[model samples]
Target: MEILGDRKFVEVPGTATHELPPLLVRMSPRVRSLERVLGMANDLIEQEDMIPLPAMPVEHDSERRRMDLAVNLVDQYLAFVQHWQWGHSILEWIRQCETTFDTRLELRNLLRADLWPHAGRSSFVVLLEDKLIPTAGVEIEKAVGMRLTFRQPPPLKCFSDQFLFYLNSSVAHTAYQTWAHMIPSPVSSLPPERFQFQVVNMSLD
Candidate 1:
């Protein structure tokens, strides 16, 4: 209150007042899903297409609707992924890590994820690379009904040393494995599964 005295304190309803509870959005670390968002961020930069969001008028109703949908998708992307175990197709799950001691901390690294308040545990973490934040933040702010920007410790800074992996016959199995290594699968109907890793025992200390 004492630092910078500029004008009298009168709250403006448009930007200052809170009228309703904020809507929460949640998302999981699904790389296939967020690729569009990354592309949208690129679009905010040098647009190869002459017609961008603003120039499109209401007459182009279909395009305008698509644009609105994209903004909402980004909002959902901003939300944290709520987890539920025991659901069908629930291959993996870790619980209550933000507040409790994580048994799987040895396997999953919280700081490795890219989202803010990176204090929780997840079986998998997905993050946009640090360099993309500035340009993407600008695009998010441009959303007609949304306002968003990046902050300190940008997303994916948490997921410092990680990489996407895949399974191929070329990746042979060894007696021992480390890092983001692929392991053999026993199922007769399924091929080998690739796994992300966090190695904590390399130090001789």
Candidate 2:
């Protein structure tokens, strides 16, 4: 079996055409269930047309009621589709945020507050990609009764500086040393430069 992109191709003896893998066929039950629901919803909307309204001013009220019912059905269908799309996207965003927060916490623990006293004094802005709109800052004097002077750091620059500083320090070196000790001697003897290089590559990927 050869895998290409999302599909697998298998060459069989005396076979003229490639067939879909068994896993794809196994998913038919779930797919059919969704299709049945969608088909039923469509049929219900269509069924409204079977009820006839009088073509005269005497039945104006009845015609209006039928139109309203049809409109409501269309709205329900649209709402279901929109919710399905938005729900998936929102869930993915939440998962990504959770992962990001966990990694940030780890970094924060490694570079303790004592190491950077200026961190609290400095306003750190969180940037989303290259955009600068949604930046966060502390209202320093808001909590305390006194007027406090606060210095803000250039967002990306501050993060880069602190990260690089820790990477070069003895704490990072010693942490890696301890980690290496727990592993086999052959693995422990691997050069620090190589480990750093591998870390950088993984981060970039």
Q: Highest lDDT among the candidates is held by which one?
A: 2
Could you estimate the TM-score for every candidate? 0.19, 0.25
lDDT of 1 by residue, 1-205 (tens): 0111431111111222222111122123333345665455334322434234566466568566556644543443343111110110111222222222234333233323342222221112111111122221222112210111112212321211111012111111111122112322110110002221221211122
On a 0 to 100 scale, what is the lDDT of residue 145 in model 2? 10
> Which residue window of length 10 is worst by lDDT in model 2?
194-203
The parts of candidate 2 lying over 4 Å away from their true place are 1-61, 107-205
What tens digits encode model 2's per-residue C-alpha lDDT throughout 1-205?
Answer: 3344643222222323322111101101112244444444445434534345556645768656655644544433333233222223223332443344346532232112333221111111011111222112211112111111112111221222223223323332353345324422221111111111000111111
- Candidate 2: residue 39 Cα off by (Å): 13
* Candidate 1's TM-score: 0.19
lDDT of all the models against the reference?
A: 0.25, 0.27
Give the CA lDDT, 0 to 100, for residue 179 in model 1. 16
Number of colliding residue pairs in each model: 7, 0
Pick out the ten consecutive residues of candidate 1 with the lowest summed lDDT.
185-194
Model 1 RMSD in Å is 23.4
Q: Which residue pairs overlap in candidate 1's backbone?
A: 27-81, 111-158, 112-158, 112-159, 113-159, 114-155, 114-156
